[model samples]
Target: MSVHSWPTQSLRIRTMFASKAAEPALWRLLSIVTLLIIALWWLSAPRDLFSAPLSVTEIAREAILLSGVWAYVLLTLAIVVVMRWRWIERPLGGLDRCYRLHKWAGIATGAVVLLHCVLEWLPGGLARARSQPSADASRQLGLDWNAATQEMAELANGTMLCALIAIALLRSIPYRWFRKTHRLSALLYLATTWHALLLLPPQLRFTPLGALIGLSALFGCAAAVVSVTGGVGRRRRVRGTITGLEAHNGILEVECTLAARGLPHRPGQFAYVCFDPAEGPHPFTIAGADPGARKIRFVIKALGDYTGQLANRLAEGQQVTIEGPYGGFDFRGTAREQVWVAGGIGLTPFLARLEYLRWLGRRSPSVTFFYCTRNAATDPYVSRLRTLCTQTGVTLALVDSARQRPLDFDAIAAGLRDPSGAELWFCGPARFGATLQRAWRTTGLPGRRFHREWFEMR
Candidate 1:
């Protein structure tokens, strides 16, 4: 027992460990740490490093102004590159992770960059910098202007614009335009790196710490390029087609079948499907299907920009490109008692799960389902699932929020044979899952009993 006199069960902990989307959070945290280290170093030093006299505040401010703007922009561009690089997103589970890391890294970098601008940049210093004695010692203590410095500064400013554009299109932005502009940012990162290296005077060029940072940026750029070129060891392509399209409950349902490339998949995993080469492919969960079969299918509901068009535009036998089958929702790796939570179209992955179970001719080994939706009017695959539960003896509890309903958590728990050992699976919107998570935790289910899936949402 680590706390509260409750025994710590790693099984539940392990079971509960699901994938997380990396947002722009981590880069911010790292940036804060850098500030702290700078402060401590400044306080302990006998003399300032800048050669000329400048207070800690002024020095910090100037540092921010110089690094703050470009770091965020460059990092954002790098993120675009990384996202573009993950062609083998599904089998290796790289695409999802890449998006997350890039997001978090950008967020982190974005924050730090802003702070560097705010907390560190000396306000309106262009004039003051010009007034400094030209004859003063060639000490690199203050902001200096030169061809190299000017070029780097311009590149940094350009990259910032690139990042802003990237963020704007994070969700609703058309995929093609975003992809092309993001590549420009990648080239800018490379440009900045070269610019930085060239400007480094003999004194700081090869310093161990400086070299390390440079190396990291270099490697990141290379990795980004490789991923884009299928050079980073990602599968070059996933060819598939729209096997069928049907409208269910006023939402369009799309069925896609892929020719297996011996790509490994697990229950709760998803694939990116394309109806037109010009239109960006979207990630849709695999409806329960046979992995061994030459073809596997996905069920998608008309939801947004790409998806809303699915029902009307894509036809049977259209050639499509798929980018992934990425996710950490695989249930086969565990042996814990299971509880699956689904919301709206979130149940698509479980369809595949049930199919897999059927193929093996085995019961889902102690499973319970708690599905939430707006109302029965929009439940995408109710008919198929009802038949499935009846045949498999899988117990289902439906919660419709549109009816102003609260999920019967206690009642659901009451039926669980081993609530403490049950592995809970959840997939839905951010707020819905978070609310359910808190409720489940309050009810004393093991932490592992709640697993949430991360999908792309604006």
Candidate 2:
């Protein structure tokens, strides 16, 4: 209910449209999917699909086959992405990016599945209009092997798949509702897997393309089982109790004492914290931690509907489930100097890094932190950040929007003694990060040197 908390649903919509630097992981995933599609299309599609003239019936048959291939590939990949396996997550640039990829894959699957269904209908509609004897599209297209039964089964499964996907992608839907309904997708995947196994052309059934699909289905089904059984991230989860909770400005600083074992987390990683089982877990950055001590802290801004209620629902001594120690935003680089830019709640990770550096007693790579906030006097973290910077020998700049112009490339570049040599680490609103990233790219800094968190995962 706090005015400062960003609405979660609106933020999710903004994240979908907000521009940022292209993720290498996303490009790599798309490339893999494209290559697989081409391989499958070449192996299974009629050799004369593009070479020779084709009739409407033949075209419809080919379109249906091609669209089915795309749906299978994307939907399978989407299932695998949600397994939350660390090895897979690390290659995909963290679990957040994996979820982003999952969302896109689901959208693409819905589209291709829709196309497949339409193609299935086209030939039947055309034949009926022309007064042909065949009422079944599969029979007219020479795809009939118990055609009526197959078509009904496909229609039932495809309709369910599309409905589930629509529920997932619509930002207007509540996340709790989405979470509950989205699990049905695994069951839907199993249904589609069965449909594919039964309907695939006999000629291509034993080919390499079929092998690829078979493997995708196997992995997807396994991931689906892991998800349905609530085993995803089970290995990483640990039980903990809330030891302290304090409200600063509109943010909550939650402290926890791990009851099981120490969660060895890097400076800038985050965790999926489940305060209430009914609400599920939400990701929060590890604001501070000591590897040896069974203690951790999270600075949370009530930016969404679920998060807004956390302050009231949580209390000291409350049992909670903590899964992770995920993310790759740790401020490690080879630059002689580091420029850190944090906007509002984005300061959490930087605060963690500063605390870590203070513990290490080393400030070899000089750092200047630009902390962006609305008001210096009202923002509680400003004083704590100043003290940490002093302890760690980091220079701190408070970029108060109320008193000064917005922080821009010029202001950041002016602070750096060598813009080209210094690596920039940023976390903030997606649009702000995109703006800064676009400006930074012009400086000829290698893209890898500019690090930021892709924190949105709706």
Candidate 3:
């Protein structure tokens, strides 16, 4: 539709979706962290870092401090993101992307911790064997604290943190175990926070770097507490009952009617649906819902262990906890033409948008929706999508991968009247979107012109 008004509580949908790229917020956050690290290094870095003939022990010590500080900051940041705070999630574009940020931050923290551990002991071991001064000599420069005892404790903590991160990164691990083990990071983070504060140089405790550390620890601890106490996303959660359940091919269509006024959500947004408490909440896009309506729909594909069993486990009238209405994939753009690509179950967001358009009786300038599926005959959505496209005045391009060639960037480009002037919105497999986005940008489309939602939670 031509910039139709959508209801939202905190931010105007029109304004929120006007932005072309979701990654600016992510990049800006990273830049801020980098600058903070640089500023802190300048404030309290060792003289040996700049002096000539820097010893291996000196370099190792410096690496230890730098990596530790980075790990601390990133660990805190990961906790803050996992809190599912709407304000933090909004700028990042969606909760799914926020989880993506969390995933990367955790991995980075793990890598930094590993680096810190290697630098902590490797140089000392070599120094001892070579008859050189022990690495402990560098500790005397500053950051005065218990040396041997704290070092042992830190190594233990670092090892454990690394282990947890490993378990998290391993997708083969059952999601239930992953969920439970992931909570343990909150405790580990608390330990790291304590270690950071306790060992910070006495003179620099009140400096800007210290303040950043302190504020981060404070916020991080708060978020960690929420996570530990099982209070994450509690305020945003609303009760709902399953009103309908259907299966089409391998997809599970879950329809729910809220017990209260529905949580405010924009079209193309998603929520964390808790169908089974034991398994916890998993994110599912709100495939169809009116703003503030009690009724909503989620189209889930059987892609994993937990979701594969949902069709059998879920039933009508069963209560559920929905913690979301998160994401900024609102179908808004500033181009002469808007192109949509949905791969299989990735059609959820676009389906929501089409329904919204039909309900509003609005039509945009020029819109093309490409629904890519294996077979159109067995795909239940094709018939309804065809009707919605007709009602909304949007062109539908069905790409049956089984019958014909796959939908590629060139195919999409061929349909566009002005490739440079059109915006592309894609929600599909990560590899598919990556290939399309690479080609789109290679052809001179601005990076901001392509809006895509990341589907990976881990």
Candidate 4:
């Protein structure tokens, strides 16, 4: 796919697979169910001061005994927990995934806040709190304003949720707008946290003592917002400059190094790099990094539009922006044998991975590199890769499509020590990787042993 459509389309498929949208739907359905439950509670609970009708006091009576409100809270917690796994702990290597998941969790949490307000305001609920002896400490301290405080709380919370939804949906909105408005959400969450605590009696502050049930939800939100916004996520940028450029056939490759401390990345992770503000901070994996020497390297091939002009117009040190080191397409988590497949510049991160292995002194694992190109003439890194593989005990397969020759995988495996148990890692066009995966499955190996990273998404 073209770069312009890459992130959006890639994310759509991933989001679908993750079923993050399910959380919002779950919350919405629960909201309707919660309303029904509250209605039931109102019908059953004592209504009068004598009969509280649906006023704040009667609603408070049911709110205290509301069954399964905690279930919706549990649902929200599940989303946050799932997201924390995929984004924070897993080696996803990119922020797009995190951002998407973060949005999902935010919406779910916001929905729960909404339900909390509505459930409590039904007749006997807030009315009871309002009716509590006016001479109580809260009233003595000017806390007699339950009506105004509840509405203020709702306004703050609802507006923050709307801003988050806007940021998540209409991503064409400026990043600065997203950043500023979304920041308000954490502060609003803090406010809502205090609002909940202040309104509830000490005895009802939690479903169970010290669990701080409702309080914990708001805290989780505040923490996530701080983590992402305060540079704990991939919020920092490292500078880089183009040092060399060359065009071979229709392929354009540019060589560059990190101009500063460089970014921390694994062998196969990519960065969302932007040379201009108008375009995307497109993903391009780290093809090479001199970890001990302190510089980042990447090789980009011309795919059209802006890339065609890369060789001629990109000056050395033109100052590029980056949001980085994302994607789980690395072998750090695995120990199996590896088969790395590449199409054109998809070979970028693999080369760096090999270099990293060499520097770290681990005997590089047995590897098979599959290089595909129209011909040897158009392959940008084939010579360098072949030389590196030969030096590092890696088997290299160069597939030239024009020759119309069948690649004898059985024959290729004969040269390898063993093919089974060896992991296959593929990066390149989606179709190319998928095709290779099918072929690998025929080898009678566990499917998980074969891995593919869709570098084309960059």
The prediction achieving the highest TM-score against the true structure is 2
| Best lDDT among the predictions, by candidate number | 2
Candidate 3 C-alpha RMSD relative to the actual structure: 9.1
lDDT of 2: 0.78
Model 3 misplacement above 4 A: 1-32, 46-57, 125-156, 159-161, 164-168, 290-293
Off by over 4 Å in 4: 1-103, 110-140, 143-145, 156-181, 206-265, 270-284, 291-293, 299-314, 320-329, 341-347, 357-365, 369-391, 396-458
> Candidate 4 on 1-458: residue-level lDDT in tens?
45786687566456433443322333454466456545544454333534434754544644443522333343334334323333453643334344444555556555665566566555533534432532264666665555566676778767865775565555445554554565555566555555545554444443342243454566456465654455333445676776655567755555566666768787888776777665535567777766555566666776655665656767776777666677777775464566666776677778887777666655554677777767776565667877777667777778887785744445445555656657766666644454555556677766656555644221
Model 2 residue 167 lDDT? 60
Give the Cα error of residue 115 in candidate 2, in Å: 2.5
Better of 2 and 4 by lDDT: 2
- In model 1, state the lDDT of residue 347: 84
TM-score, cand. 2: 0.87
Per-residue C-alpha lDDT of model 1 across residues 305-410, encoded as one tens digit per residue: 6667666777888887766556767775363578888877778777777767766677764788777777766665666777677667677776778775766566
Question: Which window of ten consecutive residues has the lowest lDDT sum in model 2?
Answer: 126-135
Q: Please, what is the TM-score per model?
A: 0.73, 0.87, 0.86, 0.57
What global local distance difference test value does model 4 have?
0.57
The better candidate by TM-score, 2 or 3, is 2
Per-residue error for 158 in candidate 4, Å, reads 3.9
Better of 1 and 3 by TM-score: 3
RMSD of each: 9.5, 4.5, 9.1, 8.7
Ranking by lDDT: 2, 3, 1, 4
